[model samples]
Target: MKTETQTTGEQKGFYKLSSLQRIGFGSGDLAQNLIYQTVSMYLLIFYTNVFGISATAAGIMFLVVRVIDVIWDPIVGAFVDKKNPKMGKYRSYLILGGIPLTGFAILCFWNGFSGSLLYAYITYVGLSMIYTLINVPYGALNASLTRDTDEVTKLTSTRMFMANMGGLAVGYGVPILVQYLSPNGKINSPESAQAWFITMTLYAIAGLLLLVFCYTQTKERVVMDVKETENVKVSDLWTAFKHNGPLRILAFFFITAFAMMAIGNAAGSYYMIYNVQAPEMLPYFMALGSLPAFIFMPLVPAIKRAIGKKQLFYVFLTIAILGMIMLYIISVIPALRSQVWLVLVAQFIKSTGIIVATGYMWALVPEVISYGEHATGKRISGIVNALTGIFYKAGMALGGVVPGLVLAYVGFDKDNTITQSAFAEQGILWLVVVIPAILLLVAMFIISKYELDDAVIDKINHEIESRHKN
Candidate 1:
């Protein structure tokens, strides 16, 4: 019988993807991010301002939901890894999990309960869990598509490009659509929020359709050949963590970096509306955040080659931090408030740094998986994704928790109109600048710990290839 090593040689090359094949894989991310960014950017405001949940209550809910993810993510990961079905292991969940995820996403936007915290909890929790079921596998599926490093980099760039397209739609399009749907531009009334529900329902349905499209179009070319062990044991979780140094570093990086982005994006709506006094300008401001992806994303492979991944990361992260500081300086000065256009320009620069560096990190997951295989003979894509998922959820937890808590800390009153208290405005400023900046600095430190580079990974791949040859 021909062994796995011979197969690896045949699979190696940049010619793994046709242009159509790239688009198919990239579209899957476009689908997921449409739903994901909607939740990340708008859900908190939906809960706090529209659905009538208090900021503190919503903060607690955000923390609790992420705790649930810690338990749920691994179960889905292990299940996908161990059971190798004929329809392709991970792609199947894009449909299975996506259907429920779509429904819950719509329900989350509904204003029927009239300030009911209970309804928010049930629907939002279901949305979070179902998203995990789909997302963990989707992440694993990226590695399954090919073992070619350059091809995966190309795939990651395309995937992130598609994701930013979704981000553009959600960030720029959602607010405008919601306002247009509302009666007389009033968002405070229940009827106004009902418009939000309708808009999001359309988005959710579209998102699900895209998931099915991704499922139909994708194929898995390389997967671990393993005997089905017993159902995944919790003990094995510890084993995966104990021996896997690269996974640990990547996990920490995901937690801090994702948390920073999530918290910043979620809080942005409030900052624009309450602090900047320009709710109408929100979509444009948000578009600026994702729009730079077109400019910078195409350049990632070249950038990585010139500076190396770690150095490029450091450069971008520092620039992002400096941009935040500039924002804070501008916000506090009354003279600068008149220059809203200038503030937006600063935001664009900051976002340029964040969007490219963070988006490219998805490609690093395969590197960690390959590293694990080099050290131990196992290539468990699921367990690695599961671990990565935990940190992502943790980052999302902070993203969820921080804004609500910060709003509450500043004593934001939901029942007010036209103007907020000075304390509340101060809270909005902190959300916009200081908190995310601090998190980014922390992320820079965490990424510094990542030891794997192109040379190191290439050596590991050679060793792994030789072992399979024996």
Candidate 2:
């Protein structure tokens, strides 16, 4: 068991994170949310409206990109872990990969080659790969920062708080901003591409600036240092996965949680535009989704202290499920067609639960890494982070592919300015409501299987530090 003195030190270190440092550490996530939400929320619409691709073709593209991820993500993970450069093993990638990611992101939103499949494929694929390069290392960078549990929580809360701030920019602000830029007030190809292009360039550039800020304010505290003479192998990945039970649990949780968030977010742009009959209100609706984080985030430590993480996840995930079901019912019933406030309220409720549940889980990565070290006598934070990255990206893939495929199958037309067919509306509802609800239910069950509580993790951390001291 950790002594009060050690725990206090951890708490102090966490509280000691300067605002600049907190913001810097948080910027990696901020950059990711900006780029990712842009892709997830608008890419399909961009394909249909601006580029003249069928919804089905876009959906197929979503799956292809994700399949490509399985091959790309792990390879990036191995290379980074093996090299362990001195400038900062994981943090350096934010600048190294970030430059290209920024350029590719802008290209993705460009409409110069409108209606060209090859153009879309080249930009989107490059953007996705570049994002992977920046993101995997960024995820690993969090664990490298510190090993103190309470400090990790503080770092996570602060990081998530900044991330939600970015979410507000992407989810709430982007639509309104882009529309304002559009000459005709409609976000279709040819006329509107320049507006999107300018907006995304601004976003990408801002994200790179944030990455630089993150690099300056942050320091690597508990990293697994690789000597200059050592070489890392891919087999080490398998060995870590085979032995690290907590890593395994967290990896599955990443898949389910990220997938749920991704699918729900992707479907939301469609739902508000088509079902709710208020495309202009999307930023407000998405803003509400992230707003709850501000209200509930400060309360996480107290909540975790009271209920424990495992129990807290169960409660909040159920709340999310119930909220989704209510939203689905509200969307389907003709009587509630004009109840935009009701939809917003449901979004807030659902978001509150999700914000609390998922936001706190990132704190567990360090805990699992600690557990792996205690169990295996080797501290391989990069490998552990890579394992979790694979599953999380897999979830993100599902989020993209399922909604795109479902909308395509239902005969959604990108070119139409008016309402879609009844079947298409139903598909939109299922994407926003039913499918995401089912995924959230799966998340609740998978979370139930996680065996580490606070006490167990604290013990593991204590053991690892003690052995290192010896």
Candidate 3:
């Protein structure tokens, strides 16, 4: 009788997951976005407006945390690759690291020690570090699930869809929930601290539960065996980085893509509240960030097949730039300035491009991982993910630093609360539109350097499997 691995097609190293299995895997990303997206899109605003810190100080703290991540992610990545736990390689972290990750995520938003940079630093740092523990392994988990390129695409599409569902919740639901819960029915004020804390607690708990679901659903089918894993070392991360050309290009792409998303996301609340002068519309505005995912993500497989991957990127990326340009024009025109509908429209256009371009990029990670595996004869998914994590954090560093520094330079007053000065509003505009537009251009260039098309990656996967068969 055949074993389950063979019955499921895993013995050939190209497993096809069930729809339920795919959704379970996707839940991991959804779980992360619920917590991390809350942090990415709202934490800066929370620190400045609610937690009582200057934008400059918050920016510095963000940079410091990323610097720490540069050191921490590699160690976690290398350690994960080297060890195999009884729970499961890679999948075990969904629960093991998730418990603490949820705690710190909730605590990061709490105002028990309000205005204490020391408290902010401690909680935020803990949150970022613990996030890496879960994020790196979760990233590796994608590649471990299957080696079939089409299945990987399907899996990535499902992951982005669910991930954006979490984004929509955080983006739209957080503010609405926070507003409903706040004593004053305001999301970005000192008075809303309790609401922020409570909201985060709920989201974090939900995220932890989803991680458990992901843990139950996932099994690592295409990973290094015992002897190959034993040879894994921290030094191997650097070796892979130097040798893996596609990984290098993809890493740069991650920095640009994430920085663009982070900068725009970080500035969104400020843009809605201050620049647009409509705090009531904040939820709808932020929700647009993820709304495109539901429409466009499902079309990614078809889009990629129709246009080819690189062309799909170029077209969507150009569309994103167009949306940014439209936004800048609307903000500057006196008549359009007050047109909320126009603002929302431009945002939708911009988000559509961004959502498609960036959302589809996750699919490339598996390709680069396979590239490294073909070259080295070892599948160090953990280490590859760690490298990507470090660069991804670097992009986030830019996202965090640029907004705070720009806001500080423009004399943004956390105390003012009602309105920012014209200069500050313009700075917020730059963060929302100009800077992100520039980053997209850079991203287009970097992705052009990516060498692995579908044909190339398919060939690589086939050759590796053939060697195994031999």
Candidate 4:
């Protein structure tokens, strides 16, 4: 029933990468997340508090831009598959997209266009599209690096560890930078718009520099030859999706994971100010979210070796859920709301599970790409990344939309920064605990459907390579 190319197991050495190579590759994500996490964590506050937009309007902009990504991602994927630039097939986009991404990312925070919905629409939409141009190709490059299953695992671990390094910087650093830049030392102060602009400009330039570093450090190995490239098409996206089981499972899981992160993160500022009643401790609270990645990500390959991948998911997802329950309990108990120590403890427990679970998921992208190639005789990594990108953006869009709508519905007053109504406080609580907990439960079920264990994936990758040799 199986073709020869669909069933072999050895990758040869073509995909092997050096330590320096892996670190360079990982830096690209580090660079991107520094900018991406900053926007995810602070952009909403900046929109309402500094950029002079209503929450409802900002939420609408988030949804509209993502809808565009749903279409734009496939086009980029198809284009990448069909063409190879002199710089590199995928790496070229890093410069092409990264340059504009830096510009527009800075523009998105500028208040010169304050109150202009049209300006917000253009800047945010441009940022998202260019981001895709960089992200989709970067994702495909992961699969192109090597077909060795274990190599990808190591590569992904290093990548995520570095990605979280960026997360830590943004989590702790943005508030610090903004506060220092603000004359009144309040990031949320309406007069701090100028400060927000200055802060983003510094961050955007750093992201560009990192992107350049990523460009210099890595090279692609396993890729489609001319024959395979000639056959690529936009229609190949649906064709791959319709037939690929692993891609579908990963795509759905991304939707849940990203949405969970987005909602919880967007609620973070409100959560500390309103629920924890410790607005002064906000930077510490946010930084704790990325702290566990340092502790657990380095142990990912060992953990996988010990418990197996599916069991690892089961363990961490359960831990994250328990941590959320603990947080909700701590917040609800009147005596404990001000207990910053207990809140930090709960946050540590929650982030430990979340970092390991979501952090390792990138390693699986190559597996799914190999599966699609084994089935279809085409290594359309670009199209596969595009499909996943669409779902991930959908999740992010919800992250944006849900928070804005929730805040609006609960009567979160933009003018009153010091305190919110009891009901508004509860809405933020739900974002922090209730919503992500439910989504993680769904993610647990979805991941259960992912049947490509390491052994099966290795066979598929080997088989595809065997076919290539013949």
Candidate 5:
């Protein structure tokens, strides 16, 4: 139970977290990815293929859920900032919201109400809304931990690494678990519905345990004072966005980055199952989406040091685009289409770039929050996170909406299980490679507008703390 003051005698607003504290805080992201990653990467496919729904129907549903999130996130953010719960300010939601989040996450994968759009909407909406209760607060928790730029970097690195571990578990392990649990060995069939439910239940319960662990391991060290928090309102979100230049830039980047990742992720199983004509390779392909994080996330601190943050982003984003181009070329070339090793290699390269670029963007969130505090007297961490959440979910909506609509336009038949038409395969290929690469290019440009380098943020954090002292 070593507190920040006891562990590090650093100045106010610059406390350094211990390794355990960092990991404990990070486990929350890991916990979230376990549930949400499964939803993001697999839920659409489960609905269209196994849950007995049209891809277009599922896509429309996804858009509607995000619309709900746009309204809900701001309210949650304002409520969290205004109220000081007895359990903990930000961390308390880790348990309170975590419980229902777990339940809804499990229910989203259940087949009891098979083909019922009403049931799907209720469960998915419940999952998305409850998720905000945890997410907005959890995001604010990062800024509350400490304002030290290096510590935030280390913390973000740990969080991304653990987050990817959760992604890897879902990407690689979900199929394996579903296969084992299924009466038959296939994952994409209606017969595997029971297995999907069982697998999600296990992952969701594990996620809940991790959230509890996160609640215990962390404390809010730096946050808005009570008086400052009292007058917080939803309109402040609009005010913050209007004034916070860096936040606006970062918010746009989140949308593009997440949309790219989401589109690619949503299309991955289809690419492997249909385009690549290798259903057996689905786990391996999806696993590659996250595996690169393990290899490269640890190096982010050093990489950022060697090359500036913007430079790092540009380099990785270009690399991701190149990897996508490679994937496209391989898919088009009759001779290379069957080269599994080449495809995996291309996936690795693409994921490497994506993992680094997107992973580091989170470090920027605290920077923007700090920037907002320096400009305005109040530190509205929840409002800022809620704003970012709105954008992030917007990107997720595109991830859901674009893929399904494209598949439908290309005449993707859920009943056809074995193969889709060439037009449909091309559509899947575009979602997997072309569309995401285009978004990455836009991400690179959007991130270029970001002005808060490490030195600037460190100065802002110092000034904010000085005001508190005065």
Candidate 6:
């Protein structure tokens, strides 16, 4: 009689998951985005104007903290792979890491530190590291679910849709809530620190609750055999990176895609507050950034199937580029700058492309996992996710670094309350348009190198399952 690992295998790679299962799984991303998006979009502005930190200091802190992630991600990945905990290898962290992450996330915005940079560092670093603890394993969990490429695509669609819901909440809700909570009705006002704290507290708790919901819903299936598992080392990440071709392409794409999103997201508040001169309309303006995802994401699987993967990326990326260009022209032209309606239209166009392109990238993760397992008999999901996590964070680092550096370079004075100079406004425009557009161009080229189509990944999955049976 053969053992479960070697033969008589009941667990197959492709399992058709139900809609409820898909939605539950997708909620995890939503939970993350709710809190994380707030940080990405507003944290810098919060640091400078509200929390009384300089843009340069915030920039350096962002870079240094992510450098910590560079060191920390591998350790967490290796540890997670080596031990199979009670709740589940991946899902358990949803509770374990998430609780502290919630505490730190709430604390990061508290201003109780009273402008203490040390407190800022401690809380932000804690939040990021704990986030990685959950993020790396959570990413690997997707591959362990099913090998159906279409199902993965659909799952990614649902995931992106839910993630955007979080974005919508942050993008639209945060500023509105902050303004409502603040005594003077100004969100970024230094005296309104309590307002920021209160707003984030509500968002943070909601995120943790959603994480629990995700924990209850997800179940991992197509994982490696227990007997096959071994001691995962830091070097395994390097090995995965060196050997996996699809991983190489996807990692680079993540870098560029996230940089574009980060730079654009970081600039949204600045653009609305300074460049647009309609602080009241900031909510509407920011909301447009994620609003397009809801309408376009549900159609991704159909779109990918209809036009094919590469073409879908090509078309969407081009649309994003066009939207960026349109935005730039509108900003530079004095008459068009005053036209908020025109700016919003261009924002919708750009965001539509960005949402689809970035949202669909999650589906590629499982494909790369299949390719790696096909090439090397070891299904090292943790290592692969750690590698991707590193690159995407690097991309996010670029987003953080660029805006702060730009603000510093342009001599953005947090003291100036009324309006910024022409040069400052121009710098802000570059953040939203020129910088992100250039990143999107790189993203398109990087994705073009991804050769694993759905049929190819499906074949790889089948071969791997057959080998398990034998």
In candidate 1, clashing pairs total 0
Cα lDDT over the full model 4: 0.88
Expressed as tens digits, the lDDT of each residue in 1-470 for candidate 5 is 01145254688668878999999999999999999899988999999988999999999999999999999999999999998898888999999999999999999999999999999999999999999999999999998998889999999999999999999999999988888888878777899999999999999999999999999999998877777787899999999999999999999999999999999999998888898888788889889989999889999999999999999999999889999999999999978989988999999999999999999999999999888878887788999999999999999999999999999999999987789999999999999998998899888889999989888988888887777667
Q: lDDT of each prediction vs. the true structure?
A: 0.83, 0.79, 0.92, 0.88, 0.92, 0.87
Q: What TM-score, computed on C-alpha atoms, does each candidate reach?
A: 0.95, 0.94, 0.98, 0.97, 0.98, 0.97
Pairs in steric clash, model 4: 8-463
Instruction: Report the lDDT tens digits of candidate 1 across residue range 204-317.
Output: 888889888888878876566655333455455557778988788889989988898889898888778877787888889888879999888888888888998999899988
Q: Is candidate 1 or candidate 3 better by TM-score?
A: 3
* Candidate 5: C-alpha lDDT: 0.92
Which segments of candidate 2 are over 4 A away from where they belong?
Answer: 1-16, 188-190, 228-231
Looking at model 3, residue 159 earns an lDDT score of: 96
Task: List where candidate 6 sits over 4 angstroms from the true fold.
Answer: 1-11
Q: How close is candidate 3 to the true structure, as a TM-score?
A: 0.98
lDDT of 1: 0.83
Candidate 4 residue spans exceeding 4 A from truth: 1-14
**Model 6 — which ten-residue stretch has the worst lDDT?**
1-10
Off by over 4 Å in 5: 1-8
TM-score between model 1 and native:
0.95
Q: RMSD to the native, candidate 1?
A: 2.2
- Candidate 4 local lDDT, 1-470, one digit each (tens): 12222223434523566788888899899989977898899999888887778889888888898899999999999999889898988888888889999999999889997878899899988889889999999999888777777789889998998899888888888888888888888877678888889988988899899899899987777778766688899999999989998899999999999999998988898888777878778888899889998889989999999999999999999999999999999999988877799999999899888999999889888888888888888889899999999999999999999999999999988877788999999999999999999999999999999999988987777676566567
Residues 316-425, model 2: lDDT tens digits:
88888888877987888877857898899888888888888899899888888778777766566666667787788788888878887888789887767557888999
